[model samples]
Structure formats: structure tokens, C-alpha cells
Target: MKESDPNKKEPIGKLISYIHRTQLKRMSRSLGEYGIGGGGQYSFLKAILMSPGTTQDQLTVGLKFDKATTARSVKQLEAAGYIERRADPEDRRSHQLYPTHKAIEFQPVLQTLLDESNAKLTRDLTDEEEDQLIALLQKLNLED
Candidate 1:
């Protein structure tokens, strides 16, 4: 196969991957002041905060993460005092994840950072383009 030309159109999947990596790196740096080591745990914390009493198994399936990754994030957040794990009433084998006061307090700041990143990413796109992009992304996401 011929080498791809940089000046030519790039694959959307590759572009999205680059964006994901860069965004994660930037988030990790920005969140350091708040004691959030990396941005990986942010989503888990947000999910738990949004749905209190969600179990680790639920998080694993809901977020499409492996069980080990989910468990590690839960453990880290719990150690940071950002979340608490309690025995599930229905299933003693599983534990429910819940956000602590610290996690709740950090949400607004996290949201602002996310909003800013979104605005920056879409700054070049028109309103219609932004809507189209979101629709396309949703369609792609649903394919999985």
C-alpha cells in the first residue's frame, strides 16, 4: 500500500483517537491541582454521582470498561475519599458505588472544564455542523 499523504484527508477514526489521547493528557494536567491524578476516574465518579447506588458491575457494563479497570478506578476514588462503596442490599457479592461530598463539590468544576474543552473543539464549526457532528457521533456510538 502507498503511504498516506498528510495533505490528503485523514481517517476519522485515527483523528478521533488522537483527540482522545490529547484530551486525556490535558485533563490529567489540569486536574492535578485538585488531587485528581488523572482524568480516567472522572467519568466513573460522574457516573456514580449521577446514579447513586450503581454497582461496579453496572459501571463496567454501562461504560464498556473491563471489570479490572472499573475495580481499579473505584478503589482509587474510594481511597481519595471521593467515593464510597457499600454492600449491595440485593446482591451481597457486589458493592454499590456512591459519590462522597468531595466528589459532589468537584463536579461543577469538572463540568466547566468539559464545557470549555467542548467549546474549544467546536469553535471552528457552525451550529449546524456541530449538530451534524453530534448526530454522526451518536450514530457511530450506537453501532457498538
Candidate 2:
């Protein structure tokens, strides 16, 4: 096989990977001041805030993250005083996660940050283009 040409168009997966890394870097920088480490920590916090008493297993599945990643994110959030874990009423072995007062207070700020991030990401796109992009991406069949 011949070496790939540099002039060739980049693969879709490569473009997606680059975009994901860029977004993560931006989000990490923005969230660091609030003691929220990146790697979807904000996502976990938001989910807990939206649906308090959700279990780690549910987060893992809902967010398409591995169990270990979910556990690690939960631990970090707990250490940062953003969330708490309580014994599940239905199952003693499982713990239900809840956002703490700090997280509740930060919810609005988080929303603003996320909105700003999204705006920045799509600054060059027209409203219709952005909607079309979202619709196209959603059609990629990302379900597990």
C-alpha cells in the first residue's frame, strides 16, 4: 500500500476526534476554577443536579461511560464538595448521587458557561447550519 497523501481529505472520525479534544480543553479550562476537573465531570454534575438520587450505574449507562470512569468522576465531584452519595433505599449496596448546595448554587453559572462554550463552538455557523449539523450528527446512530 502506498503512503497516504497529506493532501487527501481527513477522515470523519479524525475530524470528530479533533473537535472533541478541542472542546474538552476549552471546557476543562473554564471549569478548573470551579474545582471541576474535565473528562465530563460537569456532565455528571449536571445529571445529578437534574435528577438527584440517580445511581452511578444509571449515570454510567446514560452517559455512555464505563463504570470506572463514572466512579472516578463521582469521587472527584464528592471531593470537590459538589456532590454527595447516599445509600440507595432500594438497594443498600448501591449509592444514589445528589448535587450539594455548592453545585445547586453553581447550576446557573454552569449553564452560562456551557452556553458560551457552545456559542463559541458554532460561532462561524449560521443558525440553520447549526440546526442541520445537529440533525445530521444525531442521525449517526450512536446508541449502544
Candidate 3:
């Protein structure tokens, strides 16, 4: 078998996966002190904070996570004192999620951490390049 060319461009999926893993490591380290679990947990918390009273189903769909992942993240966030679930009057089987006072107080810090992480991720790129990269990534259909 012939060896592949080292100069060949990597596949987009591989590149995206690598970038995702790197981002997750950075986020996990940054959020460890605040009791937020790594990966999608902080994303779930942010969504709940931004839109209180959202349901788990909504989060699952909006965040593109499976139902079980959404449920698990919510549970972890609740146990960490960042969020609470209240009974939904409209649906007895479902609960609405809300950020607790702890989460509210930490919201600004959360935003700052996220901003710093993003800035680090794009530090090598010019502002225009960053904007173009964002636009190009957004053009992909990453649903499910």
C-alpha cells in the first residue's frame, strides 16, 4: 500500500472533531472551579439562563442533543445548584427549567469565560478572517 501524502488537506469532519475536542478541554478546565460539568452542561445552563421556563424537550431540540443527554445535563446542573425544575402547569408530565440565584449571579462570569475562550480560539485570525470563518461554518447543516 502506498503511503498517503503528508501534505494532503485533512477532511472537514476530522478537523471539526479535533477543534471540538480542543474546545471541550479548554472549557472543562475553565469551568471546573465553578462546579459546571464540561461539554454540553454549560450550554444547557446558558440556554436555561437565557430563557427561563424552557422545557427539557425544547432544550433537546434547540441544542441538538438527544433527550437523554439533555436530561442528564439538566440533572447535573440542578445538583450543582445552578438551576431548578418546576412543574409545568400546561403539561403534568413535563417540567420547566429555570436558573437559580446562584446561576444568575454567575451569569456574567460565565459570559466572560465564554468570551475569553472564543477569543483564544480565534486569536490567530484577523477580525475579517474570524468573521468569514464563522459565516462559513454556519453555512454547514449540522442538524442532528
The numbered model that scores best in TM-score is 3
What is the descending lDDT order? 2, 3, 1
Which 10-residue span in candidate 2 carries the lowest summed lDDT? Answer: 1-10
Local distance difference test values of all predictions, in order:
0.84, 0.93, 0.91
Tell me the lDDT of model 2 at 92.
97
The best candidate by lDDT is 2
lDDT of 2 by residue, 1-144 (tens): 356789998787877887888888999999999999989899999999999999999999898999999999999999999999999988999999999999999999999998999999999999999999999998898764
Would you list the clashing residue pairs of candidate 2? none
Cα misplacement distance, residue 65 of candidate 1 (Å): 1.4
Q: Ten residues in a row with the worst lDDT in model 1?
A: 30-39
Output the TM-score of candidate 2: 0.92
What is the C-alpha lDDT profile of model 1 across 45-139, one tens digit per residue?
87998999999889989988889988888888898898998899988988888889998998999888878877877889999999999899887
- Greater TM-score among 1 and 2 belongs to 2
Quote each prediction's TM-score: 0.88, 0.92, 0.93
